[model samples]
Target: MPDATFKIFRGDRDGGELYEYKVPIAPGMVVLDALHYIQAHDAPDLAVRWNCKAGKCGSCSAEVNGRPRLTCKTRLDALPLDQPITVQPMKSFPVLKDLVTDVSWNYRVNKKIPPFTPRPNVEWKMDQREVDRVQEFRKCIECFLCQNVCHVLRDHEKQEQFGGPRFFVRIAGLEMHPLDGLSRTELLKEELGIGLCNITKCCTEVCPEDIHITDNAIIPLKERVVDDFYDPVRWFLRKLSGKKH
Candidate 1:
């Protein structure tokens, strides 16, 4: 309906600055559309990673007005257009160029998690409720918006120590699978650093899938970690049996 001012970051991993562009607004126009307009009319060299503009692909993620969100899903009308809308790369990862960030670290962390291993001679049939429980986790699109909003990765830069909320969700899916046989409690304790999360629910707030990352996935996983590593009776049993968790 009217022209909107956009301040988009333009640069590489070394550094960058916000470049302002004026775009004419349209009904039902999302932030990604505005970015596409900028690419067409103004900065042709602008680098943006996007696949499905319908918001399912999760490739069009960026911080809009200082919030981690999928640009494809963020309607311009929802933002305060009176001020310049700022679109920038996810802060937790290394910026590749413009709105693209190096999220390869997440892949490396993912590689550490063991795959779903069905219990020996287990029946393939599972309760519908159990199936539904793990199904919630399958909705993760790997947008990394949750990872970007997490304080451990964003503020403390604990990429080496902590696996952000995204992987915790992954681990939860594997751990909660009824027929799956695996204990990732040890991985959560030492490698993934689940203790670092204080359950602020910041990651949950930014999730595009509306996955209950803190309540359903993370909290249950944390309890499992405590039961495996911190339960007094279990600890004694492990000690008596000459076993280490």
Candidate 2:
């Protein structure tokens, strides 16, 4: 019924530029559909990474109008159809090709996090209610949109030191568990770089899964780090107990 122009970024590891393609628009269509149309008719070589069109897949992450969002979930109706929709590859990682970014950095960061370690119990069980608390975070499909939107990684390029928002959510989910045995407070502060997050809550806004990354994950880790190392009363109590800081 209508037509729209997509201003898409295209290129490889060396560099890239925005390329525009006008395509017919249909009702209830998403950005991913538009990209597919371009690839089908106009730009056969346009490279984009995606697995499932449904929201559950978390495969279609990109910057739509400079905001991190899953392309499959972003409908055309919500955007200003009069203007060319700008779709760019995520800024946090190396761009492999048009709209496809090398998300391997996230895998490296994930490795730095301690694997889920449950306390040694011949019989391992806990309150289902306790398990329910971390379930929302487990819903993360590893889209890394939250990581892309984070200012630390987006603007500052802190990829070397900071593990990004997704990992913070990972750490928060595991640390909050009632049965998990790994205390990562020291590691959180020192190695994983939880201290870099300023609690801007930007990550929570872009989550398609609706996970409370800032309040539930980062803040709790911040509090844990403070209590473990910086709390004066806790420090004095530990000193009285002849514990090392």
After superposing candidate 2 on the true structure, give the runs of residues whose Cα lies further than 4 Å from its correct spot. Answer: 243-245
lDDT of model 2 at position 157: 91
Per-candidate TM-scores read 0.97, 0.96
Which residue window of length 10 is worst by lDDT in model 1? 236-245
| Candidate 1 runs further than 4 Å off | 237-245
Q: Write the per-residue lDDT of candidate 1 for residues 1-245, one digit (tens) a residue.
A: 58999999999988999999999999999999999999999999999999999879989989999999999999998999899999999999999999999999999999999999999999999999999999999999999999999999999999999999999999999999999988899999999999999999999999999999999999999999988888999989988999775
* Model 1 TM-score, all chains together: 0.97
Q: Pick the candidate with the highest TM-score.
A: 1
What lDDT score goes with residue 58 in model 1?
A: 89
In model 2, the worst 10-residue window by lDDT is: 118-127
Collision pairs in model 1: none
